[model samples]
Target: MTRSLIVIFTAIVLDAVGIGLIFPILPSLLKDITHAANVLPTIGAMTALYALMQFIFAPVLGALSDRLGRRPVLLISLAGAAVNYLFLAFAPNLTLLFIGRAIAGLTSANISVATAYITDISPEEKRARRFGLFNAMFGLGFIIGPVLGGVLGDHWLRLPFIAAAVLNGANLLLAVFILPESRPGSRETIDLAALNPLKPLRSVLEVKSLLPIVILFFIFSATGEAYGTCWALWGSDAFHWNGLSIGLSLGAFGVCQTFAQALLPGPAVKLLGERAAILVGVAGVSVALTVMAFAGQGWMIFAIMPVFTLGGIGVPALQSLATRQVDENSQGQFQGVLASAVSLASIVAPLGFSSLYFLFREEWPGAIWLSVVAVYALAVPLVLGLRPKAAERASTSRRRGAPENSSGDASGETADLTFRHPRA
Candidate 1:
């Protein structure tokens, strides 16, 4: 298990580094081949196009992984992404560029496969911690990738693409030799309908216990759009930040998040219990977003970065709880459904957040952050309801003679939602 985790961790970091390598040069690459008048809109369309393709393809890839096993699916996905980056490196026209983005989006569904792989090996009680470490690995890559890309981009606009392909090639080679297959076979056959985006989400919705968290997941994901869509523009306009300042600020954020995700989640869940941990994360994020809304200076933003990152605990906790609910064989499908929600959020969030950012950016620069605050605030109440009533929990603890120091998720394949109590 340790070896498996180590290998997947390395693979993910390499993949993320490749992605980060390109971020620094994508705008210049686009501008070199197209007129400026259409470049921005073209970028917007490409972003939406990629998200839309992922929304359509993620579940399909998820179902395929279930049938074929994770190893082959992952290898294929990695190879495709490598080729896509290469295509982008030498593309003669915008048509090829759009195709590259679409291909990347479709193949990036390997995230679901990767998460399912972790689920297969991790001990149930420690799944959240493992997931956190997994996130941190990618965070580490994001930190390295962009800085390296910036250095390389100074030499040539297309240089990063070549580097990305090499990084991905290295990842593929590592996986081929060291990564073992996690899921071996499927119990049921996958049909054409099973691959449809709505089909997987519908199956997931049928589970009553899983439904609320799924909804919370969607809301939480949409809220992410705020940061993804607005952070660069907002930082520049609000703080008069130059590229150096923006990169440094973002690098600071990655550092804080890496530590938070790597170290904070396990103890937080062990101390607060899974349900309460989610609540704490929600509260932290909501408060941070609120503060970020009116934060006047760049220093204030840096001060709040760690506190805001605590909210990320909510994600692993939520996933851990969901994993605890389902059996091993169905892990791929459940994760696929979650991926679908994330993809849908990617589609909706960019449009809504970017539109709001553009509409009120000048007259009300804080409007976008305020909107994110509202979205995150809504998650608090929704998650609050997921906890059992205090009176009921107390009574159940007494009836069962459960220990007073009880915390962490209830130990079972099924969630003990009916009597979950951190204090118990």
Candidate 2:
């Protein structure tokens, strides 16, 4: 692989591994620290805030990467994560836990930058495939991190954070040595407004095609995150699983997720194309959640986990499609916008599901999640039907028939007519 791709891949792995090691241990740790019996809501709030900060700040971070270069932005993010991990590892109180999570949220610009980095180095024809590969690496981290965290955490709750910090620090060293710069434009005077943390919202409104895609992204991303947001507590509550069991189960989920990411997207894309791939992946998530809702044992989830995971195919495919809506010069902005949308969903889903859990019971929350799944499924047709804008259509037409505004091919001459066709 190229230097930039390697850097990004390593960076993602480091991030995921760090996260994996900590996540399974966090709920139990929090419960111990705060002495709060029902900690999922708090956990949901932290996750929502994390997503919210990312949603709000992603644009600014992306824009900064555009001006300052991806390398610098990446270093800053990693360093921030290191500090956040240190705080988590040493937290003396629940407030400290909240603060550390909040810091991680505000500074978690790695994915946004990674998206920018992949777009920076990838060839046009290979972009989607490369993104799929990168996403798979990320999924692998999730797979391994939790299991390790769970195993290590059983010995000591704070151990995962120490491990996460070490990995992030190593990532920091790797970036310092190996990563190359990949921003598309020259630095301009930094715009203070762009860094306002709410800047992604303005960008979201600016891009018309981006709006629907963002909503879809929210539902899709929410499903994956919801599982993470609640799984540890859920496992503890329903199955009487310990931290080790929770970690192992998450590890299993991660393994299936890794498999999906590693192998699923390319074939799924080949079979369904981007939109259809997203549909199938979302379907998998929906089915998986529904299965879990009714599932009586951890073994059942293990049986069908891979089948339902579909995460490998879903997130990257949608992100690739979202990436296509803008030109290279604006990738950071678009990604920032999408990240923000994901942040909105992150906030809504966990809190929403947690509330449902509290209000009704664990079983009922399954129905609510199924509703989320259904809503996501409903969006597939709309996404599939989106047409390139008139300008894009015209440009494509010209490319195919440069010499004669109309190629002699009957198909070429007739294509513009398709554009003129009425939208029912």
Best candidate (score: TM-score): 1
Question: Least lDDT summed over 10 consecutive residues: which range in candidate 2?
Answer: 415-424
RMSD of each: 5.1, 5.6
Query: Any runs in candidate 2 off by more than 4 Å, and if so which?
Result: 31-45, 93-95, 229-249, 287-300, 309-311, 358-369, 388-424
The pairs that clash in candidate 2 are 20-145, 20-146, 21-145, 55-340
How accurate locally is residue 7 in candidate 1, as Cα lDDT from 0 to 100? 69
Write the residue-wise lDDT of candidate 1 on 144-187 in tens digits. Answer: 98888888889987787788788788888888988889879766
Flag regions of model 1 displaced more than 4 Å. Answer: 187-189, 387-424
- Model 2, residue 199: what's the lDDT? 54
Candidate 2: C-alpha lDDT? 0.70
**Cα lDDT of model 2 by residue, 165-255, tens digit:** 8878887888898887776455578778767756556555555555677777776766666676567777776677897788678768777
Counting only residues 3 or more apart in sequence or on different chains, how many pairs clash (N, Cα, C under 3 Å) in candidate 2? 4
Per-residue error for 242 in candidate 1, Å, reads 1.3
